[model samples]
Target: MSEMHELFLTCPKGLEGLLADEAGVLGLAEVRQSTSAIRGRASLETAYRLCLWSRLANRVLLVVSRFAMGNADELYQGVHAVDWADHLAPSGTLAVEFSGHGSGIDNTHFGALKVKDAIVDRLRSASGERPSIDKLNPDLRVHLRLDRGQAVLSLDLSGHSLHQRGYRLQQGAAPLKENLAAAILVRAGWPRIAAEGGALADPMCGVGTFLIEAAMMAADIAPNLARERWGFSAWLGHVPALWRKLHSEAQQRAEAGLTRPPLWIRGYEADPRLIQPARNNIERAGLSAWVKVYQGEVATFEPRPDQNQKGLVVCNPPYGQRLGDEASLLYLYQNLGERLRQGCLNWQAAVFTAAPDLGKRMGIRSHKQYAFWNGALACKLLLIDVVPTQFVTGERTERSHAHEHSDTGQGTAGEHPPAPAPAAPARLSEGGQMFYNRLQKNHRQLAKWARREQVECYRVYDADMPEYAVAVDLYRYWVHVQEYAAPRSIDPEKAQARLFDALAAIPQALGVDPRHVVVKRRERQGGTRQYERQGREGRFLEVSEGGVRLLVNLGDYLDTGLFLDHRPLRLRLQQEAAGKRFLNLFCYTGTATVHAAKGGARSSTSVDLSHTYLDWARRNLSLNGFSDKHRLEQGDGLAWLEENRETFDLIFVDPPTFSNSKRMEGVFDVQRDHVRLIDLAMARLAEGGVLYFSNNFRRFVLDASLLQRYQVEEISASTRPMDFARNDKIHRAWRITAR
Candidate 1:
């Protein structure tokens, strides 16, 4: 009988169980599983086979010696006991890796140094020369592990990690590691599906890792068949004849598998740059006959195979690591789900993502979920059976049912009664029901007024009830909710429960898709914090107010691009701006400038400190076909006004209550700076010109001296819109002209 060698197979976290099962299937004996590794005893042939065939292992280590050690000296003695001449020539190069810390060896580098000294001393005593250190491409690689007062010395047989299958040389920005991709395919049941003659597809294939792994499994090819060098390649104990026999067998099996019917496999990537690289990788794997890749988008992805063929749709969609990434990716996930439903009916799907909440927006139900780790970030694998029964079609309204039955004449007199409406959505709690009723009532009352005025965006509800302190606004078909921070006296858990209830009722009450809703926490912002981005999603939506089209970004900033309460003010500007030179100060998103231009203003100048908002303003003006005559300046409002020498017939000044933006020279307070701000604008006003001043500070008091210097009339009531009437203190406005 041949001697058995102890082996340890390391894999990615959460893949230990799968690795252990794979070891057993490979003829390893007495398999035991630990965190991210599998341990067992195997013959030399079995160990070699595992190194070639393991699709989930990172490295394969073969134990050479084990002994108890109390200190670093004892550790050196244990490694020295091994006959180094049997593994490598005295003049060959070697590398040592040490893990764990104990028995006076607290640093891994120090422990590795001690082991290296021991090995060199033993080999030098036997021969006249000693081996030198080689960190890369060493003739022999040794590993020492110190655990629980014992040391285990092993030889790294797999060398440069088994995950490096050597096919992918060019990769995308964030490519999945090869072994992790293989584990995902295995967990998705690709082996079983392939045996049943089914197809496979990846809609977002980056560099074709999943496609190549799936093709290798379906074609019965060894994962590492093309590798040139291994850790055991230079070892003296390597059995060349046995390895050639196994390699020849693997080659023949691959030939036979290729001769059989080829399974349909395809990959589609949205990035044009990655298409050629993915194709190159697939060709390098020698599976181009069975697999193909193309440059396509997820929105248009469809698997084309023989009729009546069902398969697995596997993809690792980007879940976003930065703040605003999830918001932009929401629509991507939705589009993927829509395509899957329309194109690949009855297909199985496995979607792996780091952001599980975004998965819910796909409008599908996942039957099972498995946890995995992508590097250090925890992720989930959502297993789904794509069928009609699992689609999340929102609650059906009675009107839709009536329209459907009318088309078939099924509800006519004496005919079969119309089918009952779809089942009601899950019941809301008592508090949730109350919140839902309030939202419905508010929407019913405000919707008609909004439509009559051609208003597509307005506030529907605003902290009407103290317990649910949130503001809900309607932006065409989408809803934006801002939750006010609870006071310190309130229980945090209770407040969170109330927030959940409010969120649950919003979609049903407004008749909008839940995915269209965006929520953010509202709190007091200092400095330029309000202008600071809350998310990285640069997605912007174009909305119309008055007669001009403007852009609004609800996901990026604390305040949407357009303020709902300023609708009336913007309309007034449009009504009075014809043929007049206009100047707008502190113009956010340039919505006001767009309105003035639409009102036939001869030309306009808009100024603000943020380059981002200025760019947004440019887009808004361009959207309204008024860009050539407008000027956008990026500087402090006060400084810009001081530098301007031109006169304007109409001016609007809306300053923040308090601003300490880094771009500005000094802090600005609305109450303290009002007098100086009006003076600066009054100097630039043409004869008979008008200036409108406004601010939204709850406790603001206009300087009394302003009334003495100029003829000012308060228009707070007339400028306030109906939606903002409930909050009389939303903003204070005044119309001032020269005395």
Candidate 2:
């Protein structure tokens, strides 16, 4: 009978169950599970087979001896009890790893030293020569664990973690370890899907970890087949014949698996830099024929597999770790969900993410959720079936029969008409109904005023109810909902629930498609955070205000290019400026400058620090057929005002409340720098010319000293349009002129 050796297979946390099942299948006896490890008994052949076959295990250790120990002396004695002659020659090199901290061995290094000393002493006394220590690539590697005063010593049968696989020498930032990637694929049921001749794809494949792992699993290729050296290779008791037999079998199986029809496996990565590296990894894995990678973004990702093939879509999208990262990632997840719905019908999907709340915004229902740990961060694996039933659709409106007819202008002739669009629940919750009623009331009141005033964009709701703390704005056909960050006193779950309710009611109340509604979380921004980009969609929509066209990017920026609350001020600039020199400071997107140019300003200069916004200002001016005369200067506003040698008849100064932009020499606080800012603009003010200064700091106090130097009149109320009537502190404006 073959000897049965006790074995321990260590895998990543949360994969013990799967590893245990695998061990039992590989002919291990009495399989047992523990945290990050599986314990079982196997013959030497089975042990070798496991080392080659395990897709999820990190290392496989073969138990050599177990004994009771009370202190370091006992530890030495127990290790010395093992017959060294059977495992290692006296001149052979060895290494030791110690774990746990009991039996008077408080430090791992001390515990390892004791074990090493005992082995060397026993060997040296018998053979007159001692084994040398080689930490890397040792002939014999030993591991000792002190558990509740009992020492269990084992030989490391799998050298260097099995997850290395020898294929991925290069990877991207935050790459998933191979074993964890395998576990994700296993939980995602990639094996079953692959066996059915289905395809696989990864949208955000960083270095193609998932694609290569999935390909190896489908092709019946042993993960460690290409490994040249192992922990037991140089051991005295190593059985080369048994390992060779298993290796031969794996090779034959791989050959056979490859001879069959190839499964379509592909990866798409957004970063062009990772494309060649991912392809290199695929080639190293010997799966270039089956797996391919391309440089593509999630927004345009489409898996073009063989006809009639349906399989899995899996990816580990970045769950941001920095502030304001989640806000931008919302659109990424939304885009991914949109792609899955529009392109990959009747398929399966698994999204492994650390941010489960962002996953909720994907607009799809995950049928099952499994919790796992990627390093120390707790993550969730969302398993979804991309069938029609899993899609989250908005409330359906009644359509006329003529609209439902085919584009050929004929009723169904022979082919079946496409399925009617899915509809959400018609009845809303009580809270949602109340919110919808309030939105309808606000829209009715604001819609008439907006149409009468020729306003295409305006605010409709501004935290009307304490429970639903979100502002909803209408941009023609699109809806922009900004959810105010709830205070710490409110339960986050409750706040999220209220937000979901409000979102469900927004499209219905505003008479817009749900897809046109963009949602963002509004928190108090510090420094230049508000100006920083939140997304990369780069989609700019052209809208008109006061007979002038302006471009607004609703997805890429936190604040759309045009400020809805500042409409009145922009209109006033247009109404008051005629053949006058206009100067606009802190001209974000230069909406005010556009208005001034449209109102027949002789010449205008827009000053800002950001070149990106200055370009945007240039575009805004060009859109209105006034470009050469409108000089767009990119510099610090205060510095530009100081260096100017000219004066203007109309000047609009709307500075941020706080800015610590990197372009500036120092921080600029509106409250602290307003005096200098006003003094500089007042100097640039031509005689008898008007200067309109405004800011949005709620508690801002006008400098009392400026009251005595100039003729100043507060026009905050008059400048605030009707849309912002409810929020009296939205902004403060003053009309100033030379005394």
Evaluated with lDDT, which candidate comes out highest?
2
lDDT of 1 by residue, 71-176 (tens): 9889989999999889988898999999999899999999999999999988884447899999999999999988788898999989999999999998999998
What are the TM-scores, per candidate, against the unseen true structure?
0.78, 0.72
What Cα-based lDDT does every candidate model obtain?
A: 0.84, 0.86
- The best candidate in terms of TM-score: 1
Clashes of 2: 0
RMSD of each: 7.6, 7.2
